[model samples]
Target: MRILLALLYVSLVGAPGGSSLPANDSFRNTIQSILNIGQITLFHIKKLRTKLPAAPQMEFSTPSIDGLTSISRDLQILDNELQNPVTDLLSQIQADVSSMEGRVRLFALTMGCPVQARPRGHPWASLFPDSHFYLILEKVQRYLDTIFLNKDKLKVC
Candidate 1:
C-alpha cells in the first residue's frame, strides 16, 4: 500500500545511502507502529462489541498470506459502523503489516531461514468467532515483535 511505499521511500531516498538509523532500530520502530495501529483497532472493536455484542468478526482463510487479500474487503464492510478513527486506524494497519511482513521475508531469505507453515483455520476461528480478528492481530504483533527484537527468534522464519 501507499503507506508502506512512502515509508520505504523515506528510508531509502530521504536518508544518506538509504538509512540513517541502524537496521534494528528502524525495524523496531516499524514494528512498534504496526502494533500501535492494531491496538487501537482492537480497542475500537472491543468498544463496539461491548455496545453491540453482535459486532462482526473478520475471518482470514487458511494460509494467511493468501487470505490477506480478504482483509480490505472485510474492513470495508465494517467501515460505516466503525467510522473515522477506527476505520482510519484499521486502514493504516494493513499497509504497515504488509511492509513488515515483506521485511521479514527478505530477512529470512537473506539469512537462509526456513519457511514456517502458515497457521491454519479451525478451532481458533470457529471457537472465537467474535474475537478472531483480535486474536489474529495479537498473534501478528507478537510474531513481528519477537522476530524484530531477537534475531535468534527469527525462529519466526
Candidate 2:
C-alpha cells in the first residue's frame, strides 16, 4: 500500500511526459518576473517626473510650430501602421510613442507654456493662484490621453 501511494504521489506531482515540476514552476516564476519589471518601470517613470525641473513656458516659432505639425503627421503614420490587418508588436510601440509625442506637443501649446523656453520655472504655476497646478495637470492629462489612445498598439517584442 505504501509503494502504491508513493507512485500515485509521483504521478500527481510530475507533469505529463515526466517533465520536472520545477520546470513548470520556473515558467510561472518568469511570468511573475516580467510583471514585476513592468511595475518597476512605471514606478521609475513617476519618480523621474517628480525630479524634473519645473516646466517652463515654451516659445512658439514658425519652426517650432512646424515641428508639431510634423509630429502629428508621424502620429497618423503610426496609427495607420497599427491599424493594418496583420498587426505586429513593433508597429504597436511606434504607435504608442507617436501618440505620446503628439499629446505632449499639444498640451505644451495649450498651456501657454513655451515649447522652446519661458523661464527657469513655471510662471503660471505661481502667478495663477486659482490655476496653480493647471499646467502640470494638463501635462498629466496629455500623458493619459496618449497611453489610452495607443494601448492596443503596445508590442511585446
Candidate 2 regions exceeding 4 Å error are 1-20, 53-157
- Maximum-lDDT candidate: 1
lDDT of each: 0.43, 0.41
Model 2 / residue 69 / CA error / Å:
32
Candidate 1, 1-157: lDDT as tens digits: 9999999988778677545367667656644553455455445445544654453455444212222223222222223222223234344444545444454444455446644443332222234433644544544444334433443343333
The residue pairs that clash in candidate 1, if any, are: none
Clashing pairs in 2: 57-114, 58-113, 58-114, 58-115, 59-114, 92-153
User: Which numbered prediction scores highest in TM-score against the true structure?
Assistant: 1
- Tell me how candidate 2 scores on lDDT: 0.41
Q: How many clashes does each candidate structure show, in the order listed? A: 0, 6
